[model samples]
Target: MELLQPGESQATRLHTPKGDVEGVVTCVTPWHFRISVPEDKAALAATWLRDLSDGYVAFDPDPLRRLPGPIVVSDSEAQPVTQATGVPESHLKPYYIGIGSTTDLEPLPAFTWEEREPEQLRRTPLFETHRQMGAKMIPFAGWEMPVWYTSVTEEHLATRQAAGLFDVAHMGVYQAEGPDAGVFLDSVCGNDISALAVGESCYTHFLDPDANVIDDTIVYRRDQDKYLIVVNAANDDKDWAWLNAVRDGKVRIDSQRPWARAFGRRVILRNLRDPKEGPDMRVDIALQGPKSRDILLALGCDAETRKRVLALKRTELCEATIGGFDLVVSRTGYTGEKMAFELFVHPERAVDLWNALLKVGEPMGLKPCGLGARDSLRTEAGLPLYGHELAGPFNLGVGEAGFGSFVKTYKPWFIGREAFLAREKQRQTVVVRFRFTEKGVRMAHLGDPVLDRKGRTIGFVTSCAIDSEGFLTGQAWVDLKYAEEGTPLYIFQGKPQSLGKSPAELKTGDRLLLPTPAVVLSRFPR
Candidate 1:
C-alpha cells in the first residue's frame, strides 16, 4: 500500500459491489480520510459506501502513475472523526469515508488544546425570591435553580398532602400559529394533534426518524390557530431547531407519511420565552397538590375567573386574569395530582405571582418546592424523564417507556410512525417502576445494572429517587420477560467507600458490595 501525506490531493477510485466510483481526497489522517464527490453523484457514492465491507481504493497522484497496491479500507467507527489531522481545514464539502481497521487502535485519552471558560449559569425571574427564602440553589440544566427550600422530603410530602409551589420558568415555551398549525403539528408529533379541541392539551413525544424520542412534551391547544408546546429545559434549543427544520422542509419524512400541504409556508413558530417578542412572552409556574384549588380560589381574581379556575379539569386550560396578572392557566402538572395547575405568565409577573400564591397558600400547608422534590415526585408518579426513561444511552422510545398509548399509531402518517411500529413489533425490553422493599440501601443510580435470580444481567436503572415514603423508588429498563408485576430483582449497588480497596484488589470486596433486593411494581404506590 502507498502512504499519502495529510492534505495530499489525489484522485481515487473506490471498488464496491455496485461498481468503481471516482472521488477526490479532501483530508487524510493516520486512521481515516474524507472524500469529496460531485453533487450529482452523491447518492451513488453513498450507496457505494454502504455496500462496502472490506473494500479497496486505488490512488493516482498523476493519471499516468497509479499506486502499486490498492489501499485496503474497512468501515469502522461510523461516528464523525474529530481527531486533529495535520491537514488544514478544507472549504470543500466532504462525505464520510472510513479507512483501515481500528480494532487494534488504543483509545486516545481526552485532551483539549485550549481550556474553555465555564459558561455562566442563568437565573430565573424569581431567583431573588428564592434567595430571599433561603432556598438551597444548585446548577440545573444551565440554570441556578433551587433544589429545595427547607428539605426535599419536606417539600415532597407537602405537595402530596396539601400544596407546593414551584418555579418552573426555565422550561421552554413555544407557540405555533397559522392556518396549517394543527396539520403541521400532527406531522411532527407522535400524538394526534387534530384530536385536541381548543383549551385541551396532551402529553406526547418528538421522535427522530429512527423512532428514538427527541423529547417528551406537553402540547396545549390555546386557540383555533395557535398551540403552546412546553418542552424540557435541557432540550429547548434542540427542540427549537428541530421544529424549524421541519417547518422549512429540511427534514425528510417517510413516503408513507408525506408532509402536509404547504407545510413550509403555512405555519409560523415563535419562542414565547424571548423577551424581544414583547409583553406576551411567557414562563411557567406550578401550583400542585390536593389544596391547589383552594389556594387558587383565595387569590385576588374576579368571580368569573375564579369560577373558571374551579371548573377546569385535568388537561384543560383557560386564559384568565388572576392576582391582577394576565396569564393562561392550565390544569396540568408533572406531579401526579388530580388538582394540580401550571400557570403561564409574562416573565415580569412571575415573581409577583409566586409571592401571591405563597401569601395565600402558605396558610394551607403550601411549601415552596424545588428541582429535587420535582424529580422525586415525578419518579414516584412513574412519569418519564427525557435523559432517563425516554432517551439516553439506551435509545428508549415511547413504547419502551410505557407511554406508547400517547403515540397515536392509528394516524396513517407521522414522523417516526413506521419505525416506531416496527420497533414495537420486535421489542424485547421494557421500562418498569420498582421500589425497594427494605431500607438502609444506597440510592439506585442511572446505568446501575439489574440482575435476575441466577445473577444474569437483565437491564439497567433509568431513574431513581428517595420518595416521600422514605423508600427508594426508581424506574428500570429490564428485559420484557422480567417485567411482570411483582417480579423479583436486584439492583447491583457499587462498592461503598468504606469497602476501601478496589474490588479487583480486595479479596472480599466483591462479596461486600451487594445488590439491593427490589420488587417490580405495577406503579409507585400513589
Candidate 2:
C-alpha cells in the first residue's frame, strides 16, 4: 500500500478474513495507513485494519464512525495528536473527523487565520506590564492587549465598589500647534476648537469627507494656539494620515510616537507640560467614589484644591506631595461618583507618583487595575469604547453628536461641520442598555444583532457583558425608531443552525435600568 501525501486524497479497499470490505485510505504515515468506513461499518473496519496490520498500524479505535485517519496508532492506542506537546502548530494542523449529524449542506472555500500575513502595528510601552500582570491578552484595534487581567466580572466589581486604575498609555496623543492650530482643528475635528482656551479640555470626534467618524478624541486646549488630542491607539496612524492629507496652510501637527509614559499619584495631569516647549500636558489620574475627595484630603492637598475637587470644578494646580514625592493635583475622574479628579504630574516623576497613589489609596479601597476592569467599568456606565462603539471613518452618524450639547456650543467650527450639522437635524437617537433574560444570559458584543418588537433586526450591539452578579448586559447603537425609553428589543448571539434556522435571541428593556441588581458604578462616563 502507498502512503498518502499531505494534501492528496486517497481511497483504499480493505480485504478482511470474515468479508471483503471497502474503506477509504484517507491518511498515510511512514509506518501505517489510516482508513475511514461507513458509520455502520466502523467496528468492522477497525477490527479488520488492526488484525491485518498486527503491530504495524495504529489508530484511534472508537465505536463512533468518524475518526481521524492516517494516524500511526501502532506505537500506541492513542491517535497521533499534533497538539500533545502543548505548543501551537507552526503550520496548518490536519483536520480530524468529528461526530456528525448532517443536513442540507453547501460547499465553500476554506481559509485560516494562520494564512494571513502579519500586520505592522505599534505596541504600547505597557505591553510587558500587561503580560507580567497575568492578563488574558487578545487582539484589539490591531494591537495585542489584555482582554481581562482576571475574571471580567471580578474586575468589573472591583471598579464599581471602589477605585480601579487602568493603563491607557496605548492611546494616541498628538500635539497641534502653530498659528493655525485652531484653524487646522476647525477643519479636521467635528467640534469647534476656536473656543478651546488654555487649561480647558473637551471630548470631540473627527470625521471623514463622507462625514463618517474618523476617531473620537479628547482635545486638551493647552494654550490659545496649542492643543493636544488623545485618540484611539488603533487609529493613531490613520488619524495622522488623515491629518497630513487634509492639512491646509499653516497648521502643524506632531504625532507623539514611542508614547511617553507617566503615572498618576495624587493629582493627574498637573504641571505635566513645559510652558516654553514640549506638550503643555498633565498626567491624568482618575479619583472616583464618595471617598475620592477624602482620599485627596488625606494626601495633604490644600483647601482650595480640595474645594474645587468637591465642586468638580477647575482646581488650582497645586503641589501635594505623597509618598515623599510631589504631584500636580487636578480633580477629575471617569467614574460618575461625586469625588473624582484627573491629577497631572511631571512625566519623569510618573512612576513614583503612581506608586504613591496606590500606597495611599489602598487603605481607602483603591486598587491598581488593568484595561479589562477599566473597560467593564466604562461599559457598565454606558460609555462608548473606541473600536466597538465608535469606529470612525465609517460609522460617524451613530456617535455622541446628538448628545454633545455641552461641548458643541463652546468651540469654533471644526471638521464635519457641514455634514454633522446636517445629519444632526434628522438623526435617529438611541440609548443603549443591558438586557438579562431567563434563557441563557449572553453578554452583548460587537456585531450582535439588535431586533425590534416584531423580531426585525434594526441595529447591532457595540458592547455587552456579564457583570459580577452574573447578569448579562451590553450596549448597542440602534435606529432612533427603536431607541425610545422602555423600548423592547431582543439581542441575537449565535449563528443560525441552518439556512432557515433562527439565531439565538434575548429580550431586554431599552430604558435605563438604574440601580439594577448586580450593577456597580466604578467609572465615570467619558
Candidate 3:
C-alpha cells in the first residue's frame, strides 16, 4: 500500500487463512503490492483466490503465481505470511501486482505523474525500415518502437553537429478540412484554430475536466479552413475520441494513411500486411542540422528548388522528384537546428531516398540516428515528450508557465475547459529536472521529493537524470514557494521513510543529492 523500497515487516491479523502466516512486503515504482502465502498452501490459495477480483494473490514454489483475493492493507498496517504457514520474506520474490487509485492510499502531500502508453501499439508504416537499420525496439505508446539505434549521446550529438533520421511515422496525422474545419478545430482543441494562417503550425493541448493534460499536438494550417493535427501516437485514440465526441462542425475527420498516392489506385485496407497491396504511400525522411541546407544544395537540386527546400525561416511546402519518386517537402526539423526538411516520397522508393540522403550527408558526419538520440536532443531543447511531459487531465492556463500563454486562447474544447479555467487561478507551476549523481547514474521518473540544504521540507524531486556529459539533471513541479531560481534542492537516492516523527536527515552529496546547476531553467523551460 506504500511506495517504499523492498523490505520485510511483521504483521498480526485477527483471522488467519493459513494459521500464523508471516510474509514480507516489497516496493516497486508507483503503488503496487503482492502477497506470498506459504508454499505448502500456495496452490490452494491460487485456486481459491483465482476468481477473486478485489486483488490478485498467487503462490509459486519455484515461480511466482497470482492468487485470487483483493488483499486490502494500509501504509501503517502490515500483513505477513510466516515460514510455517507460508513463505518467508526472502523466499517470496516480488513481482508486478496492479495499479492503486488515489483513494486507495494516504494522499501524499504530493502526487505522482504518469503518461498513457501509445495505443494500437502497431508498427509504423516504416517498421521494417527501422528494423533494417538495427533500431533497439521497445514498447512506447502501445507501439513497438525504436528507443535508439546507437547510444543516445552519439545520436544526440550527431543531430546537433550533423544530420540524423527518425521514423516519426508513428506520430498520428489527422486531417480536418472543409468549410467548418477551422470552427470544428476551435471547438475541439485547446487553441484558437481561427488564427492559423496558411502554412503555419501551432502547439496546443487537450485537457480533461480535472485539468489533467490529455495530449499535446502540433496543428498545421494546411490551407484555408483546412488543418492537419499531428498528435502523439499514444493519444491517437483519446484525441480522436475527444474530437469526435465534441466536434460540431461539418468538417470531415480523417486519419490519413501515410504515403497515400494522389493518383494511385485507391483501396481501403485494415493493415499493411494484407496480401492485396495497392500503390504504397510516400516515404518521409527528415534532413536536419546546420549543414543541412548545404548538403541539399550539393545533392544536385536546382537553385530555386534548394531555396524552396532549404529555407528554414518558415515551413514551406514544395514539390520535387527524388529517385523517380514524387516528393512533398517541408522545411522543418525537431532539434531546433538550422535548415531542415522532411521529404515525403513513394514507399517503393523509400530505400533509395534514405540511401541518397545518407550518401549526401555522410561527408558531414550525418548519421542514421534512432529514437534515443531524438529523445535526448528534444528533452535538452525543453521540447515536451508526448507521453512523459504532456498527457494528463490537468488545466492548461494555470498548470505550466509560458505553456498557456503560447496556447491560442480558443481551441477545440476538450474535457477540462470549464473546470480548468475555474481552477487556473489557484494552481502552482513547477518544472521537473532529471539530474545525475556522482556514480554517473542518470535520474529518471517522478514523485521524488526535493529537500533544501537544511533538509527542510521545501519541495520534491519529480524527475532526474545524467546527461551525455555526466552532468546530473532533473525536473519537478514543486511548491511555488520553493520554485524560485537559485533555490537549493537535494534529490535522494532512497525512498523517504516517515519515522512517524520527522524525516531522516542524510548527507546530500552521499545520497546523490547535489546543488542544481545554474542553467537548470535553460534545459527545462516553462
Candidate 4:
C-alpha cells in the first residue's frame, strides 16, 4: 500500500477476489500512477481493480498514454468518488487503490500460482512487414519471429544458389569503450581480443571460470578503444550480466591474468540495442549467399564507399553510408558463405533497409528468409548453435564442438583457459556432423541415440535438418572412438506411427522402428 513518489517505479502485486495479479507500478506524477500488467489479462485486471477499489478509481483513456502492454492510469486526487463520468463499460480503465499502507497490512503467505500466464512475446521492427508478407510466425527466443516466408527447402536453396536476406534485428548488440576495453575483453573472452586490429572482427566464446560456454559471440574492433559485440539473442541478458560482473570485478580472475586483476580499470559497457543510449543504437540485418556482395553493391553507395565495401574481406568491417543510412557493414555471418555480410543499422531504419535490399535484390533471386531456413543453412554449413553444439543439455565447449583453434591458448590468461585446456586433454566425446545416406526419414532430434552397426549406443544427436540436397544432415556428440570421418552409424528414431505397442510396453533392445543409416563426415558438404 506504499505510494511511490513521482518518477519512481516498484515491483508490486495486487490481491483480488479472483486471485493475485503481479506487475510493476510506476508513479508518473505526484497525483497520477500507472499500473502495467500482462497484455492478455488486461481486461480481467481492470474489472478486478474496479471491484477492489469500490468504484473509487477512475480509468484514463488518453491515447498518448498507451504503451505496448495494457496500462491503467488512476487519478489519486479523484479518490472517494462513487462514479466516473464518460467511462466506457467495454474499455474500463485500470487503476489500483490500496486500503492501507504496507506497514499496517498483515504479512502474506508465499504461494505459487497454479496457472501462470506466459511472458509476452516481443516483436521485431519488421513484425508487421512479415505479417503483411504472409510469413508464418512462431515464438523463437522470446520473440515472435517469422519461421519462413515460403517452404524451408525453397528458401534454403535460394540462399545457397543466389542470396537470402534475414531480419536478425532480434540479435543482441553491445558496445565496450575506453582505454582498457580491449584488456577487459581479452581477460573474459576465450580468444585474444587485443590481437584484433581496427576494422577486424573475430569469432569467440564467453567462458565461465569452469570452462563452460556462456555464449558464442563476434567482437568487432570499431576503433582503437571501441569494440562491438554481437551475441545470441537468447543469451543477451545473461551475457550482459556476465560482462558487467567481470568489468566490476565481481567475478574472480586468476592472478596469471594480471590485466584482469585491475578491477577498477576505466571501461564502459553499453547496450547498443537500448534507445536510451542515443546514437549507439543498432540492429542487425544479414545478407548471406554467393551473390550477397552483389546485392550490397546494388544498394547505391558512392564510389569510395563501394570500393571500401567491396574490398572488405572476411572478419573485416567498416562504417559506410548506403541508401542514406549509416551502417556498420561486416563481411561476417552465421551462414558459412565466404561473401556474406552483416549490416548493423539504426533501429529506425531497419525496415527501410530491409525493403530496399529486397527490392533491389529480388530480380537476382534474393529472397527474404526466416528462422527455419537460417537454421537449416547453418546446420548444412556445420556452424555451431549455442544450445545444441556448444552448451545446453550436452554441456559441450568450443573444443568439444571442434573449434578449439579459435581459443588463444597462448594468451597466458582468460576466464576458463586452464579449465578448457584440462577438459580438452581429458575429452571422451566430440561433436561431429553426419549425413543420412538415404531419404524419406524423419529428422533426427536432440538426445536421439546414435548407434553403431552392432546396435551399441555410440552418441546422441544435438541438432538435425533437411539439407537443400534432400538429405538429413545433423550434428551429434558421440564417443571419441566413433568420431572419425566416414564412420558408419545409425540413429535410433522413436517408434513409428503405425506401431501398436504403447511406449511403456516397449522393451529394451526391441525394435520399434528402423534405424536410419548415416555417415560421419569430417565436415558438411556446403
Kindly list the per-residue Cα lDDT of model 2 for residues 363-444, writing each as its tens digit.
9777656566666666656666666666522253534323345325223123344455566667775446555554255445
Q: Which window of 10 residues has the lowest lDDT sum in candidate 2?
A: 257-266
lDDT value, candidate 2, whole model: 0.50
* Candidates by TM-score, descending order: 1, 4, 3, 2
Badly placed stretches (over 4 Å) of model 3 are 1-121, 248-285, 296-300, 314-325, 338-340, 344-349, 392-398, 410-417, 432-442, 456-468, 494-519, 523-526
lDDT per prediction?
0.78, 0.50, 0.52, 0.78
| Tens-place lDDT digits, model 1, residues 15-81 | 4445556666644653357666555555767655543322333222222211211234443333332
Task: List model 3 lDDT by residue over 61-180, tens digit each.
Answer: 223232322434423333454433333222110111231112222211111235455445677666787788888888876778788877777777777777777666656656665555
Reference-based TM-score of each model: 0.74, 0.59, 0.62, 0.74
Q: Which portions of model 1 show Cα errors greater than 4 Å?
A: 1-118, 255-265, 495-511, 524-526
